[model samples]
Target: MSDAYNSSWFAEKLTDRSIRGIALETSALIRAGALPVGAKLPPIRDLAFSLGVSPATISEAWSELRRQKIITGRGRNGTWVSGDSFVAKPERLASVGHYGAGVLDLTMAVPDRALLPALGNALVHAVSTEKLNSYERSRILPELEADVRRTWPYEAEAFLATNGGYNAVYTLIHALVPPGAAVAIEEPTGMRLLDILEDHGARIVPVVCDSDGPLPASLRQAMLSKPVAFIFQPRLHSVTGQTVATRRMAELAEELRDTDVLIIEDDGLADISDAPRQSLGRVFPDRVIHILSYSKTLGPDLRLAVLSSTRLIIEQIQSYRSFSSGWTSRILQGAAAWLLRDETTAEGLKEARRLYQARRDNLVRALAERDVIVPSGGGLCAWVPVASEPFALVTLAARGIAVHPGKKFAVQPTHHLRVATSNLTDRYEEVANAIALAASGG
Candidate 1:
C-alpha cells in the first residue's frame, strides 16, 4: 500500500498496454529496484483506468508474472512483488535426476540402452538418401513418410517431421495457442508436458483419467472452459502406462462431436507398446493432430518424431519451425526409414517389446507377492500407489533407490510413485520389497 509506487506511476511508466508489454516493463522495474520486494501493486481496475485499458488485460499481465514467481497474492488480498527473477523453468523435470552416487535411479522413464537396435547399418544406408544436405525446408523425407504411412492409425492429410516428440508438442502449442488460452490435458500426464504448457502461459484445464483413459465426464466438464486443444497420450501413457480403451475412445469422440477443440494425440511409446495404437483422428481427421515419436523404439540420439494433421495445421507448424531448425535432419530421417524397413530391426524391436514386458511383469509380480497390487500396463514404468508421497520418497531414498513422486505428474492430490521398470532387470525382488515398505509408510 505504498503511495510512492501507485497507479499513476505505473500508468506513466507503462507506454505499451498489451499483456506482454505490461508484464515485461513491470518485471524490469522490479529488477531495477524501482519496485522493491513486498511492494503491493495497484488493483486491476485502478491500473486499467489509469492506462486506459481493460481490467482483463492487467489481470492477464499479473497472471503471467505469477507464473514466473515474480509476484504473489491475488484478488482482495492484493498483489505484492515476491521476487526479481523472471526466468521460469520446468520445475518437475529440473527436480529429478540429481541423486548422489550408489543410488538406483528409477526416476527417468527411458528405454534401456542395451535393448535399442544397432544403428551401424542404418547410418550406412542413410548415406544414399535422395536429398542429402539440401537447404530446402522439406517437411519430411519422401522415404520416411512412405514408411510411416504404412502403419499410421488413419489417413492423414499431411505430415511434418520434428526434432523430437516434445519439440513437436512445444512447436504446435506455441504456434496455435495464444497466451492465457485454456488447454485441456490429462491429469496424470508426463511432467515435461506440464512444463511446456506452463512455459507457454497456458491456462491448463486437467481432464481426469481412470484405467481405461480420460473420463468422458471429466472431459465434458473441461469443455465448459472452451479449451483450444486437448492433449493426451494415445498409447502407453508415459507415467501411468495405461492405454486408452477402444470403447473409451468412442465415448470421448462422442463428447467432442460438437466442439472444435484440436485433439493432440501423443504416441510417445511408438511400437514399443504391445497394445495397438488408437486415435480420435479416425473420427475427426480435420481436427485431430497425431504425433508418433521413435525416441523410445529407436535411439534417442536420432531425435525424430512425425506429426500428421490437416494441411492448414501442418503448414502453420512448419511456418513456426522456419524461425529455428527449419527442418529435421534428412540423414536421421533416412536412417529411421531404413531401420523401419529392415527385417533385422523389426526382429530387434519385437525382442525388445518382449523383454520390456517381462521386466514390467516381474516388478508387478514381485510387488503383488508383498501384498501390493498394481496394474501391469504397457510402458517403461509402473505406477504404484503409496500411503504418502513424502514418506514413500524418504523411505525409498533411505534404501538407496530413487523414484519419482506421483505429485510431480499430477495436477490434483495423489499418493503414488512412478518407478521405472525398463532397467529393473536384476533387482526385481529387492526393489519391490523397498516399494512395498514405502507403500506401507514404513
Candidate 2:
C-alpha cells in the first residue's frame, strides 16, 4: 500500500465499472499481490478524491462491495477485506429451497398472484410521463416521492425501493448493522432473517415471546448483558401469523427505552391487515427501523418495499442509498403509486382479505376436524403446538408436504410448528388429509 498506489492505480481501478474491467483489474492486482486478504481500504474521502468521483459514488461502490461480502466496515475502524467464507448479495435467496425438493410447498407464505391489482397499464403511462434517464437520475423523481406519500404517508425524506420484502430486509440490515455485532429477534421467527443476520456477521439473540409478544423481561435481560439489535415482523408476523397486540406494544417500548438498541420492524406481510396498530416506531421513534413490502398483499413478483425511521436514521440510510443507486426505480414507484391510488386495488384487497379469511376458516375447520390445535391471528400462517418437531417435519415431508418445524424458529425448542395458511388452494381435503396423517404420527 504505497502513496502512488493509493493516488493513481487504485483510483483508476475503482472508477472502472465494466465486468471485464473489474474482474481483470482486480484479478491482476490480486495476482500481482496488490490487493490481499485483510487489507484496509482507503477512507471514502481519499478514495473519492483519487477516483475523481463524488464521495457519495465511492461510498456506493463500497456498499456494493460490502453487500457482496467482499469488504467489511468496522465504522471508525475503517473497511477491510472480509474473512467470512460465504458472501451474500442483495437479491440472494436463503438456501432453504433445498428442503423444497420432493416436498409440497406448504412452508412458503407466498400470496396468490390473482389478488394483486392489475395496474401495469397505468404504470406504463406514468413512466412515459416521468421521462426517466438512468438509475441515478430517477431515484428521487417527483412521481416516486408522490407514490411514497400516497402509499405510506410519513414525514420521511428519502426512499429506497427494493426488489421485494426480503430485499428490504437485506438492504436495511446492510445499512444498519456493522460487521460482527448481534441482532435481537423473536424466538422462532422466519429463518430467512436468521440467515441474513448471520450472513452480515451479526449474531442472533433469541428474545423469548410470551402470550402478548416479545417478553419484556427477556428483552431487558439481553440488553443488560450485551449490545444487541432487535428484529421483529410486527404486523402479520411470518412463520407464525402473530400480530403484537397494540397495548403490549407500548409496554415493549417502555422496556427498550432506557437501552441503546436498534429495532428493525419487518412489516413484510403488513398489507394483509386492516386495523391500524401503533407502529413500534411511534413508541420509540428514534430507535426503530421500519420496513414493509407488498409481497404478501400484492404479488410476489411485484418487488417493491418501503423503509422508514427517525430523521437521523433516514439520512444515514439515504447516504448509503445515494452512493448505491441514489433513488427508488421511478417507473416501478410510479406504477406502485398509481396502484396505491386505484380504487380497484383497494377493492381487490378487500376481496383478498375475504378470501384469505375464508382460507383461514377452512384451515381452522380442518384442524378442529382432526383434533389439531392452532393459535388465532390475522396473518396467513398458524402457530401449531405439537409433540415433536423432527417427527412432524419428517412425517409431513414423507407425505409430500413441507411445514417449518418450531425448532427452526427458536434458538431452542418449545415443540411448536409454524404452518403457513396462505399457500392453501381449493384442495381443502388434501390439506386436511396431510394434517391428520401428521397428527396420527404417520
Candidate 3:
C-alpha cells in the first residue's frame, strides 16, 4: 500500500510507442514481477515530464492500470503497486488431481463436445465479412453488446462484457467490496470463485446452501455484518445444481430490500440448464449485477461474458476495463456474435442443451437408484454424497474414473463428490457401477 513507482525503470524500458507504450512496458514489467508489490509509481506529472509526453497520456495510462487493479492511486497519498492481485493464479490441478493416460476424467464442470458450436467456422465467417478495426474505438463490439442486451434476462439499464465469468465476478467484487470487507457467498460454490475472492483479500462470510439453494435464515445472519456485497450462483449451483426457487428468490430479494448489499448473480449456465431461469435481479433491479458467460455454450477457449446491471455499476466496471484490460478480444466477440445470432450455431446450441440435460438426468436417476443421493440441478455436474469421500475417490480412481472431490466446492468439509457427466457416453454403465461401488463399498 506504499507509493513505489520510480521514474528510472520507465526511462530505461520506454519503447517507440507513446504514452501507451510506457503503460504497456510497465505492465510487462509488473507481469514479470520486476515491479515488486508496495512499490510506489512516480507521480503522474513527474512520469509525464520524464517521458516527454503530455500529462494527459500518463493520466490515461494510470487510469488503465487502476481500473485493472494493477495499481492503486491514493491522490495526495500517491499511487502504489497492486500488481500482485492481477498475477495469474496458477490453476490448482494438484488439489483437483491430474488424470493419467486412459483415465476417464470427468473433473472439470464444462459443456460436452456435443455442446460446443462449430467455432472455427463461425470465426471464419465473422473474420471474412467484418472489417477489422481497433477495439479501442469501443470497449464492447456494438453487435455483441446489442446481442447481450437483446437476450439479457433482467431489465438492466446497461451491459458490459468481461474476460469470462470469473473476471466479471472479480470486477464486481473489486468494484464494490473493498479489501478486508466481509462479503457473503454461497458455501458450496464454484471452487475457482472462492479462490478469486480470497485472492482479492475479502472476508468470506459463508451462507450454507440446501437443495433449494441458500437458506433465507443463513443469508439474514450474513447480512448482519453489513457485508459490502453478496455473490449468488442462482442456477446450476456448481456441485449441487441447486437453483434458487422462485419463492426463495422473492424472499431473498425482500430481505435485501433497502440494504446496500450488491447482489452479484453468476448465471453462466442458463442456456444449457433444463430448469427455468429465475433471478433475484428482476426483484432487486437496482441492487443486482447479472453475469452471463458463453464459455459453457460456445467453448471455454472463447472466454467471453457480459455483466449487466444499473448504469452506475456497469459504468464503474466499464471504466476499470477501459483503463485496464481495454476491451475484450474483438475477434472472439465477433465470432460469438456471429455464432449466437447467425443460423450456423442454432442447431449446435439446441443439440448441446438437449444432450447435456439427458446426461445429467440419467446420471441423477442412476445415482438415486444406487442410494447415492444427488439432485440434478440441471447442470453438467452431479453432487453425489458418499459414506466415505476419501475411500470413494480412491475406489473410483482405481476403477480409472477421475472425479473432482466435492470438498473443493464447499466452505465446509463434504462427504460428496461432484461427478461430471460431460464425457459419459457409452461408459455410463461402467461409470455408474464404479461410483455405486465406490459409495456403497460393496
Candidate 4:
C-alpha cells in the first residue's frame, strides 16, 4: 500500500458517520485482486493522515476487514492480504455455523422446544372442540381476542392475531405504508424485516444508531422526508444487542406525536431485556402498531404473534387481512392463547431469559480475555468489534465456527460482527475456545 493515502473516496464516504465507504472500497480492492494476496495495508496513522480522518477510525475499518478474513494481522509482522481462496462468502441461511464442532449452538435464536409443554395437545383440542362453525365466529372467537388483549395490553377492540411476527409486520405495511412511501429504520437493522419492508413498497431510509440507540440527528434528518413510519426493535435489538435508552424513547415519542409518522415497535424479545420499558404503543397508543411474538420466548414453531393498533388502524388492517390470510388459523390462535395463560409458559420465559443472559455473560468474559471489546448485552446476540469482518469470518470458519458478518445488519458498511450467544447451552466453553482460535488468526 502507498504512503500517499487516497483521500477522495474516504472523504466522500465518511460524510455519513454510520457508513464506512472507505473500508468498503478497500474491501473491493481486496476482492478484485488490486490489493494482491499477502500485500500489506497502509499503517493506521499514515492512512489517517492521508485521508484526513482519525487513526482510530482507520483502525476500526481495518479491524472489521480482519474479522471477515480479508486481511490477516500477524502481530509485528503487520497486516497482510488474505489469499484469494480466503475471500469466501457467507451462507444464505443465517447462523448455520455458529458453533464449532463438538460445541453447543450459541449463534441461533430459537428457544428450547422442551420448555414449552405439549403444544400439540392444545392444537388438537382447538381443532376438535371448536363450536364456531361460521368463518367470522371462528376467526374472531371471543376467547382468542381476549388472549390477544392479554399479551398486547391494548384495548381488545384494537388487536388482531397474525400468522407470525413477520406476517403482522407485512399486514401493517400493506394497510398503512403506501407503496414508495419513505420508511426509516435503524441502520444495521434486521435483514428479514428490511427485505419485507422493501417488498411492501417502502422507500428505505436508514437512521444511524449509537450506544444510546438511534441518534436524534439521524431521526431529525429522516423525519424531514416525511416517512410513513419508523421501525425499531425498542427492547432487544437484533444484531447489536443494545437497548433503546429511556430518554431517547421519550424524545422519539414526542417527535412522532408532532408528525404523522407512526412507530412500529418490534418487542419480540421484550421479556429478556434487563429493564423492559413500556411499549411505544403505551405512550402513544393511537399512532404505534406494536408487535410481539412467542417465537423468541416459546419457540419459532409457535408461529403466533399479536399485532395491536388504535381502533382506526385495526379496522383498516382488518380489511387487508381478510383479503390476504382470510383470517389467522383458529387452531393456532387458540393454542397461543392457551400457551400464554399457562403458568408453565411464563416460567419457561423466565428460564429462557436467565439462560440467554448467562450465555452473553460467558461470551463477553471469554472475548475480553482475548482483548476483544464486546458490546453490553441486550439479549442473545453480541456485536463484538474486530479487525476485518471477512478475515475473522474466514478464520473462524476454518476452525469450524461461524458468525453473522456485521455488514449484513448495516444499511451500509460498518466494521463489526454480531456474535450470537443463544445457541451456547452447556457447550459454551468449547464455543469460546473456537472463538479464541479465530482471534489467534491461525
When summed lDDT is taken over every stretch of 10 residues in candidate 2, the lowest stretch is: 84-93
* Residue-level lDDT tens digits of model 4 in 1-442: 5332244434443443322666677777667766677676666665577677787778767766665667888456667778554433332233344454654334555555554456765676677535534467223445766765654544434677777787788778888887668999998787667767655546788999988788888888999889989998887787788888889887777667788788888877756765655567766777888887767765667677777787788787888777766677677777766766778767877787787888788878877877777767658788877667777778766666667777767667776767777766555566566666565544
* Candidate 3 weakest ten by summed lDDT: 85-94
In candidate 2, residue 6 scores what lDDT? Answer: 56
User: Once model 4 is optimally superposed onto the true structure by TM-score, how far is the C-alpha of residue 356 displaced, in angstroms?
Assistant: 1.8
lDDT of 1 by residue, 1-442 (tens): 4777789999889988899899999999999998999999998999999999999999989998998999999989899999988666798898877878899999888989999989999999998888798899999999999999999999999999999999999999999998779999998999999999988989889999999999999999999999999999888898888999999999999999999999999999999888887789999999999999999998999999999999999999999999999999999999999999999989999999998888889999999999999986878999999999999999999999999999989788998999988988889988998999999976
Give the per-residue lDDT of model 3 (tens digit) for 1-442. Answer: 2333456557667764475676677777888887877788888777777787888888877766775678886678888877764544524333777678899898977777655777787688567534465556355677887777776777777777678898888777777777668889988888878877766667789898887788889999999988999888887676677778878787777778879898888987767765666667787888788888888888788888877888888777777666577667778888888877867577777778777778877887777777776765667788887878889989998988899877777667878888887666656767777899898744
Q: What's the TM-score of every candidate structure?
A: 0.96, 0.74, 0.76, 0.72
The segments of candidate 4 whose C-alpha lies over 4 angstroms from its true place after superposition are: 1-107, 128-133, 137-140, 151-157, 426-430, 433-442
The clash number for model 3 is: 8
Can you tell me which runs of candidate 2 are displaced by over 4 Å?
A: 1-103, 129-131, 134-160, 440-442
- The CA lDDT at 73 in model 3 is 69
User: Model 2 reaches what TM-score against the true structure?
Assistant: 0.74
- Which stretches of model 1 miss by more than 4 angstroms? 1-3
Candidate 2 residue-wise lDDT, 1-442, digit = tens: 3333454567665547443344345445644566776677677677667666676766655655665566688567887766434334423234344654656676666677777677667577656756665645443446655665554523444555666667767677787787667777888787777767767767677888755678888877777656557887666677666677777787788888888888888787766876563467656667776777876765665567777676677666666666566666666666766767778888999889877767877886788778886766666777777777777777877778777766666666567766767767667678766766676654
Q: Flag clash pairs in model 3.
A: 3-40, 4-39, 4-40, 5-40, 5-41, 5-42, 64-323, 241-377
lDDT of 2 at 357: 69
**Residue 81's lDDT in candidate 2:** 61
Q: Which prediction has the highest TM-score against the true structure? A: 1
